[model samples]
Target chain A: MNALAARRRHPAAIAILLLLGLVAVGGAYSLLAPKQAQASVVSAGDINTGKSLFLANCATCHGMNAQGSAAGPTLVGVGAASVDFQVGTGRMPLAAPNVQAQRQDTSQFTQEQIANMAAWVASLAPGPAIPGAQYTSGQNADVAQGGEIFRINCAQCHNYAGSGGALSRGKYAPSLTGSSGKTIYEAMLTGPQSMPVFSDSNISAQNKNNIIAYLKTTQTEQQVGGMTLGNLGPVSEGMFIWIFGLGLMLGCAFWLGQKAA
Target chain B: MTDLDTTGQPSTDVVHLDEGHHIGTGGLPARFEDPGLPTHIHRMADDSPDAGRRAERQVVALFGLSMLATLVFIVAYFAIDKSVGIFLPGIGSTNALNVVLGVTMGISLFGIGAGAVHWAKTLMPDTEVVEERHPQASDAATRSAAVGIILGGGEQAQLGRRPMIKYALGGALGLFALPFVVQVAGSLGNPTKALAGLRSNLWDIAPGVSPIRLMRDPEMTPIKASDVTIGSVFHVMPETLKDSQHVLEDKGKAAVILMRLDPNQFSAAAGGQRAQAWGYQGIIAYSKICTHVGCPVGLYEQQTHHLLCPCHQSTYDATNNMEVIFGPAKRALPQLKITVDDAGYLVAPEGFHEPVGPSFWER
Candidate 1:
């Protein structure tokens, strides 16, 4: 005990004790802590390629380390789904800085290039991943249930028919008319700009597929009634009636007022 | 009559009426010679018997067409299947039954109208008649007589003779409206009581009672802190709401929007700091009711941390203590002080400090 007490006063003793404690805690944590769920297995070579691609193409605005700069937000934990949504949808490599990034018909990068970039971003931290094909396919999904979920959660901004709507400032919820099922899944998973994230826990994969199915059904569904009047509900219908219907009435009245030939 | 020149000067020429002409009381001619209607032009049917017979046949044909259209309408109603769709050139795809029924009905109504109008123009009397219009107002004596009769009736009832009866009747008639006024006012209930109800919600915990757990809206499942990830939003309601008698009413004031954001994202200002301190880790909850016009502010932009009310476009900065960043909302959205319970489920230890939703006079 006297020998240990003498050694305890040594300057290196405290450092040794702290090191031992750290190792013990780290070892225990590694052994007992729950493992983070990874969406897919990615190789180190893919990650390296992704880093190189990011550094070459995105480093100007996102910084060399992916830390945010004055012009762009930090992409450290934004995840692979975010990259897929932004790059896959051609919203990134922004044409120019504006209120919001617009979706383009053709993406700047190919699918393989986007995957490499997503892998690199995913390596930085844990986040949402690109959803599986089963969940995004919208095959055999319950359209009715999906419709109910959509009405309660997404109808406010996306419109009842997914026609899109205006937001504050210059922002807007883009129309979902021709969006791919994969793009829709990623957008919901990542909650890209001006959109709230509906996490996997909030809306299960099955339900998300259901929502996709409902969207697809609506896009393909034929309008049973005559003219939809732009599907703007009562406002456009009212305007059409006022301009065309009333004009027809006025024309008939004028014809009646004329003397018979 | 005097003629005025274009140069703004009256001309010397003056025309006068004949001395034999008589003036009425109002300085108008007492009588004017009738100017007969313009010479009637004979129609083809009016000039020839064969043409008249042809006109009759045409009218009968229009009437017969109307009857045929009516019969077609009945047949289409029974024969056409409701589910069948047809492609129209301009209208696109439409229900076959609806189109057929509408067309038949329109034709049926148009035939009758056209047949009657054609008969009147070609076969009926073509001569025009003149009808004179009299003045609209009654003469002065007749109007005075009406007033006198009303006054005499009142006198017969002793309304004028007895001042007390006249005044009493007026008071009684005026007071008769009090019941209706009272009924309307009473139906509105007490404003103070209603305000008190609005001020508190299901989150309110009495002393010694356990805090209320935040449950998922619609699903009513309790949420653990770990389930909430950064950038995720949850629609929440107090667990106590499930057992309440007035579920919808309580839900209106108690509905909350729970969101998880990075801790570093919160502003360093006092409001932001307070918001952070009141939250659990990076998760924060706020009343979903907009401080504008009581709309459910559900449009949450995860990147911008902006909560937008679908109505009125009221935008609230979620990272800045729910401050009003834009729109007509006068105040910030009230934050709900949330913390996890023993089970790690999110709970509200206390209720909102102020009322939720749009401001009222009492607030």
Candidate 2:
């Protein structure tokens, strides 16, 4: 604190001290607490009716505790944000199990029902709740830094092309061409599917934003040479060369080497 | 008297064979033996006893030297280390084993050749050979005679009757042959243990801790909820590999991909239209570890919102549930459920919904 701060502190010392103490506590809370976007409130009407609707509709497939069973993945730690993203978009209430989960229409869950389901999921595990579908704060913190971070962390499996690849079994890691920074951050906040959670501890908010900037900047840039298959760097690119490109080259080389002169 | 057969000198030079002849005298061969043939030059050893004994001893010494060289080759083979060279400050490091073994093997083979040539030159009959022209096909009688001639040569060698000479020659030849077997097999016995090292990598991020929080690799930094903007993508991973023995140095092969999308755009589960609290506001994380052969799936396209695996152009739709959109990968990247910790940094709510790394289990 400067001289002015000291003077300000001395004047209504008790209240100022109390205020300072509160700010300190807030800082600590902010560190641990999810600094959620201060979006508009969920209407009283939706939440009030959503409670009972949730009990009746969702208790069967998902456990009453909201812990997943044979029919579904556990929803204990998943937040309303995920619920809104999944249900509001109609990816939930899947028609059937398959290689990839598909998005469908949202008429099945009424607004109140959707709210209640989100609340019920929250009851099991309190996480980032989804506001309607509106998103702000798409601006990233940095661009050049993000590129460095991406190269070190994401280049291995995701490839330089942003093309996804296979993992053990049928699981795969997807690309991030047009995804909003909010979704990217939330996904980090809440690991959905097979993606692990990259907590703020792992990658600071500034670093995450930097990564976002890198992704956005590169999207529209004109690629120098046209073809970039997988871009998973060596593993994928090498395979293409070995299987098709190199094979063709080798064939030509063999012809030249054995030209019967 | 000496337990040895004494040879009778062909030349009766008991008194004097003058300066005109001191052994190795030449004479024409019988006409029936070689018609119009050159003279048969007689050597001093054929007619003199002392000179022949001297030549025999010289051949034995050559064999003895060969046996000594073979012994040294075995010593060198067993002593050299086939270990990788480490950097040293001043005197450069080279493959010591290669140099030592190469020199020893070279010496071993060279000595044998030199000794054999010496034996032929100084001990064995050095006279030029001339074979009579005959039909290619041999009669049984001639075959038997050839076998008899070989047997007679073996007797002449006295490999068995001369115990000292036989043992010395055999020892030399036997030692020469043994190092070859040792040379090839000596450096090949440690593979079973080495193979296991390549199989199971040190990527386990610890145990008991579910959903090891994904952290930015290398720097070990944390991600914040407020930082990510809409229409942006971030590649992320767990903070600490406490649940497993995850090492940062190995992240080049094990990182994951992350992106955020509009909630409305994201597909809901069959459970409802409302999205699960999977994202803070709409952020999602996916394994960068490719589902197809485990390549790191990256190079995300912000416009198309596609995750592309550089390996085979496999794309994953982030708007959907990370389903494979294109290319060879069969499944979506495993997702790690996450939530904010007390410090507001994103942390794994639980471990990955599915295992991480490659499709190691066809099972």
Candidate 3:
């Protein structure tokens, strides 16, 4: 209203007020620097939050303490590897129990939430975390040893030929022929289907790497004298040997006798 | 004067014979009746006294050869170490003991046969007799007579009383069976069945320990939450399985498959339902071990959301409380309630609701 009052409320005063505001913010930041000033590294202490979320959503089956109750397994030491593989891909909080926990879209938990949960789980049983999308451990796996182990432990189900096999009911052992190392690693880590969990306690990470190496070797070396027929196994192999090899020999013998005569 | 001139030329080769008798030179077949073959023959042994003695020797020799062959067969059975690979040059077969036993046995048998043939042809009484072939089935009289012949032969041999040769032959026969006995009883010592089974088991539900992880076979790495995608299938286990600590082996049965699904589509497990706490938002887990035979029920169909077992084709409907959807499995796979721990990893909230793998009769 008055000319003098208007002049006093000028742009300079506004600029000075802005400068004070900036200084106050800078001072506050400096005071709290050690405790609150970290980079965008998001290793939040969200495990407590995750634990609560787990009890609310997962405890019904998993139990309140995550110790496992009726209709669930004991989660004493499954590790972050299992947690990440299960929830990261939305296989956890399964739609329902099937031949296996089928992988689907629409994860219920966010990546961050899942991470928090993984951290908590890892605390219980510290072990291998989820493998990266491409697990490229260039260590050469011993194919012969792998084959022997495969035959001894996995052949009955996955098939000696790696063609995979059926399980009781409608379940089946999956084929390892084309699975990427990541997929294989995740599958082992998560135990997504009717598969049981294999903690690092069960199979060492090095052993897993060796197995992957062997798989790679086999994927390349599968070619042999023709007509594998999915290698349905010894019975089929025997059938082929008898039908082709022995049959030809018999025919030759018969021809020879006739010619001699 | 007439007889004196001819009498000087008396018979040069003449042998007297009885009424129905004949003589043979037992020389080359060219001089014999049938000239095709010059068979092994006996000379004066074809007649009386000396002939009988020769016949006895030949018969005894044949039996003795048979005994020797059988003995050799037994020796060959035991002589070859099983680890040695057999190589046969003359024949295609290559089993060491088989070849050696077979050759020795053939030689012994051949000697026995030759000895017997020599005895029968040269020394057995030479009288021509004929018997008529009749019906396929022998009459009672014929059968009895045959029995009588056998009995008569045995009696003539004085087998029971003589004891020495009889006992020796018996002992030889008994010894011939020794190899088979050794094969059966001796081989029983090595039982690989139990060992092989333990070597390849999928579940290890023991007691008082952490338990082995239910790891995916081949690549047996432990699982984490982030790796599983919705509609993804996983074969899982505990991390404890890889540990060297013996105690973890006890609770291997606790392995479970944790999965998440859309909660609305999921069906609660059947059988007098209690609290609807078997699953989470959609996450549900079950034992990988089959409830029937212990094959891992790992085949998962994402669209159908079904778990299929390879062994007997048992199916588990994940949305329906892990119930038996198909195949020989009598019970549903045991479900395990699972959740993320404070650190954001997958963990079983507790042990399985029921025993894993096969449902025991005791259950």
In the range B34-96, model 3's lDDT, one tens digit per residue, is 334444343466545765676678678788877888888888788887445443343322456
Q: What is the C-alpha DockQ of each candidate?
A: 0.26, 0.04, 0.03
Per-model TM against the reference: 0.73, 0.34, 0.38
Q: What is the DockQ (computed on Cα atoms) for candidate 1?
A: 0.26
Q: Which parts of model 3 have CA positions greater than 4 angstroms off? A: A1-161, A164-212, A219-230, A245-261, B1-228, B238-255, B268-276, B339-345, B359-362
- Model 2 lDDT tens row, A99-194: 544445333565556667777677666677553222224363567777777676555445455565555345555676656666566665555555
Q: Which tens-of-lDDT digit does each residue in A18-103 have in candidate 1?
A: 99999999999989986643233433337888899999889899999899799998899888999989987889988999999999
Q: What are the per-residue Cα lDDT tens digits for candidate 1 across B138-193?
A: 99999999999999999899886789988888999999999999999999989888
The candidate with the higher lDDT, 1 or 3, is 1
> What is the per-residue lDDT of model 2 for residues B37-139, given as tens digits with 9 covering 90 to 100?
5665656565677767776676566566667766776786677556644232332344555555555666666556655654554445645587889888889
Best by lDDT: 1
- Native contacts conserved, per model: 0.53, 0.07, 0.04
Candidate 1 lDDT score relative to the true structure: 0.85
Candidates ranked by DockQ: 1, 2, 3
Model 2 TM-score is 0.34
**What RMSD value applies to candidate 3?**
32.0
